[model samples]
Target: MFRDRGPAWRQANAGHVSLGQLKVTSAIESCRRASLGGHVERSEDCVHTQIAYNACRNRHCPKCQGAAAKQWLAEREADLLPVLYFHVVFTLPAGIADIAYQNKAVIYDLVFKASAETLTTIAADPKHLGARIGITSVLHSWGSALTQHPHVHMIVPGGGISPDGTRWVSCRPGFFLPVRVLSRLYRRLLLEKLIATHKAGRPYVFGNQTPLADAQAFAAHLAPLRNAEWVVYAKRPFGGPEAVLAYLSRYTHRVAIANSRLIALDQHGVTFRWKDYRVEGRGRQKIMILATGEFIRRFLIHVLPKGFNRIRHYGLLARGACAGNIARARELLAIKKREDAPTETIADADKPRCPCCGGRMILIELFVRGETPRHSPAAPTRAIRIDTS
Candidate 1:
């Protein structure tokens, strides 16, 4: 799709496209191509040679997240606890999505802060769990159709450490927190922060949302949502630690849409599979087709600000004290840490081997860009060595 329509889209929407978006487009287009450079591998049996191009390694690119996901999962494996895990989602009202698109960094950060505060505060209340729960929150900015729907998915352990730091406190078997209580608190906190941010002259309102720049107008804009029920959905506890890993693998490094979901791409548009959450049963799994320009626009809207982390940890899972906290929690629960296997260096063990004879291939030569790879064997000559200090 990029090769077919990227240039025209750029020319038409030059004023709207961000440098980050342009860079994503260029990287995706050039990924795995000779333009980015690559390495040539030859078979040990001298039967075949293959050229493997380099990857862009951009987080937003659909084709570049496999190795990244593996590495992330490896790191998270050590942090997993044996307790039941709950999946909770905090979503911003659609009315705020427009403003979020214009001020992504600010609004997204606000969403994380407000949501985190709501969870921790509610969980810490004496009437509730009254424990300092750990939270792993991942920010997702796109809905099924690639719309600008910003939400945070949190994985909360079924229990927490007591306030007195003396014992572990577990919630009821099935329940995490009251949705009604969480909704009210989240709404209040988010609105308060939004109003404060607007007052500080930091909120950016653009396009048809210009009227929201005024305090009164902005307040009025948020009036309906003040009493409206905010959606704080909590799924059932994961079956086990393996289930938690499986779930994280799906959400942690996901792009707006995976390349596998793309059914077709042509001059007409890009057609892909999408789940319509509003519908029920089989009707929900439907297909959506959007114009190439529209598709690109939707995808780019989800390009988060550079250096902004989409995944964050809080409370017991916070980076500064997570290790100590996890250790303490495990000790209190009378749980022993699993001994990890001895680490082995696999740098050479995992190298690709000849498909025909299963023999190792050695690097025989290096080729630069625009230079043809010489298939001929090197001529024997006297070795001349140069020394530089």
Candidate 2:
């Protein structure tokens, strides 16, 4: 399903993406070639060797996030503990929207930092029912309307440990952190960062074009944000381990809106469904129709800086001490490795088959790690994606 993306009739009217976006589009189109050990097999009669330049499988590349997600999940499977978890969202005020645009890399990074730090610091405080917590924060850059709306969705386990890190501290079954408290602190942290960054840079290099470019004007612009209630909503607890994985699957590598959500792209631009969060998500109530160029422009804004990791781990999952901490955590819980716990499976479907006998085919040779797949064929000419999102 990741392979075939044919140009859609809808994107026809959507034209002329910005200059900054061209390279990313090309990168997405060219990722994962046979040269990089991708699938490109030749037929029996072929004599000419084929050439396929492999894709640099980077997460920012829309084509590669899926493969990364699969590989990443395989590794994270070892990190999962048997615990119920909470889903918390941290959102920003639209007042900070313009500033975020001017400083996407830095501001986005701050969003991750502030949100994670807030959660970690608060959770660790003795007054707040302190305990070490595991959290997975995924950055989302777009709203359903394709706007550059940046927020971090955090999946935190329902409980944590004592401030001294001895015993587990559990929350009520339905609650995690206090939403009112999280929102108040999140707003303050973000506004402080926004003001600091604004003052640090040409803060108003483009202010001459704006009525709000002056210090007073900018201050006024940011004033309401001081009291604006930022949204920090917590969803009910997830069912269990598989549910958490399923939740991560949707969010961890999500693009603005999946091709599946696209309704139509026509003379008026593109029309897609977005949830009206202001109202209960009773139904897909709003239809956002955009000019094709504008739609492309909005989509391009989400492409992050090269190698910026949108998914992050905090607290116990921190890389440096993850293994030791997890071991200690398991011992505390008296959890032991299951004798029947599944190891990697070699699926029959993935095994080689005989062309002649319809029996399982034996591998006469194996390609070692540094070695390439055998008899690799040239990658196919670029195919058009008929699919749309």
Candidate 3:
């Protein structure tokens, strides 16, 4: 689909596509191809040979996420607490999504900051949980249909550490925090920071949002959101820490759309499956067809800025401090830490078995990109020898 549609999209959106988006497109086009270099493997019996191309490993490439997601989940599994985990979602209202699209890095960072402050502050209240909570937040910029709908999905422990750090404070069963309270605080904090950013001349505004370049215009745009009830939804608690890992496996490294979702590609357009949340029940699983340019445009809009982080940890789970905090929490709660399991290296696990004989395939040669494969009886001077055993 990219090969067929990418050129037209590039032509139509020239000068508008970001360097990050262009890099993503280029990487996707070259992913798992010999142009990026690869190795040749021969079966134990030397009767079968296979060429394995290196992956581009670009974060946005749908083909490269499986291994990355697995590795990430493996590391995260060790951090889980033997406690209930709640799934909370904080979403931006449509009024703000326009400005968010223009200032993705700034707005998304504020989303994380505001949401984290709301959760930790409320949980720290004496009338509430009165403890410090940990949060794992993942930002998603697209809805199911690939439209720009910015939101943060959070995996939060159902409880927190007491203010004095002496005890494990658990929230009431089946409850975390009041949604209305969280909504109000998040709205206030986000607006305050956004206005401050604009005043500092740091927030980006473009295209139809050029009016927001004026401070008064920007303030007027955010006026309605000040009184509006922002959306802060908390789903039922995860079954357990194990269930949280399963959920993260699906969401953590997800792209706007997976290759498996593409149903068809032709000169007319691309057809893909998408869920319509507004539709009720089974009817929501619907199909959408878009012209090639339109589809690419929608997908590329979600390409985040370079070096911007979409996943963040907060409070107790803050990276530098999580280890000590988690250890202390587990001890206070009388929860036993699971011993590390012996496991094969990722390469050993991912090594492909011979398709012809179901035997092991060993790397036999490494080829630099753009170099022609040698065909002579004698191996090339540059070929590195490997043990077949």
Candidate 4:
């Protein structure tokens, strides 16, 4: 779809699109093609050969996330505690979402900071959990229907380490934190930061949002949101560490939409399946079609600013403290520790399998960008490549 209409769309929306989005679009269109180059692999038993092109590795590419998610999940496995995990979501109301769309880098970073602060502050209160907690937060910019719905999905352990570091603190079995309390604090902190950021001249407004460039107008725009009920939803506790892992696999590296959800892409437009979350039960799953240009636009809207980290760890799970905290938590829980596994790089991982004989396929040749492979995997059906490394 991008290859067919991308040029026209770019021309039409030239002023609105950013260079980062264009770069991602270009990468996705060229992914797994000869332009990016790849490797040639041959089956050990049969002389079957395959041409496996390199993935773009752009975070926004749907085809690129599977291996990335798998590798990331492997690294996070050891960090999981043998405890219930809570799923909490902090969503920006429409007013803030509009601003976020315009100033993604600034507003999105604020979202991360504000949300993290809210969680830690509330958790540390004596009346609440009263312990230092850890959280893994992933930001999702799009709703199921490809709308710009900015929200943060957080996976928090059901408990935390006591302030003194001498013991572990657990929330009630089914309850993690009060939603109303969380919602209120999150609203205050985020709005305060948003106002501060605007005053610092960090946010940019455009088109329909141009009026917000003025201080008074921006304040007025945000006034109603201050009183509105900010949504802070807490889902039921995950079954166990395994369930947490399963949930992480689904969301950690998700793109705007997966290719599997695409039903058709003819001239009529790009038809894809999207769930209407407002609907109940199975009826929520429905199909919708958009013009090729419109679909491309919506997809590109989620292309984040370059080098922005959408997935962040806070509190005990933070990079610097994770190891020590995890070890201490394990000690407090009286769980037996296992030997640490050696870290494996993508290249050191398992070899791809042969489609013909099911035997392992070994890398035979390497090619640089735009280079052609010497050996062609004649029967495309018999040539296999695993989307891992």
Best by TM-score: 4
Per-residue lDDT of candidate 3, residues 13-118 (tens digit): 8998888999999899889887988887877964677677789999999999989998898788778998899999999889888888878888899999999999
User: Candidate 1: TM-score?
Assistant: 0.91
Instruction: Find the number of clashing residue pairs for candidate 2.
Output: 12
Q: Write the per-residue lDDT of candidate 2 for residues 1-389, one digit (tens) a residue.
A: 11232134225434644334555655555565533444322333433233234566656565566666666675777777787888998876676666666556787887888788888877877677578887889888788777867788999877776667677777767777788888888877876776776677534435433665566666788898888788888899999878888788778887776777788866676777888767775764787887666666677778776657888898888888888777777766778965655655434434444333345444333333245766644444454689786
For all predicted structures, in order, the TM-scores are: 0.91, 0.76, 0.93, 0.94
Worst 10 residues of 3 by lDDT: 374-383
Q: Stretches of candidate 1 above 4 Å error?
A: 42-48, 343-353, 358-389
lDDT of 3: 0.89
* Winner on lDDT (1 vs 3): 3
Q: Which order, best to worst by lDDT?
A: 4, 3, 1, 2
Clashing pairs in 3: none
lDDT of 4 by residue, 102-194 (tens): 789899899999999999999999899999999999999999989999999999999999999999999999999999999999999999998
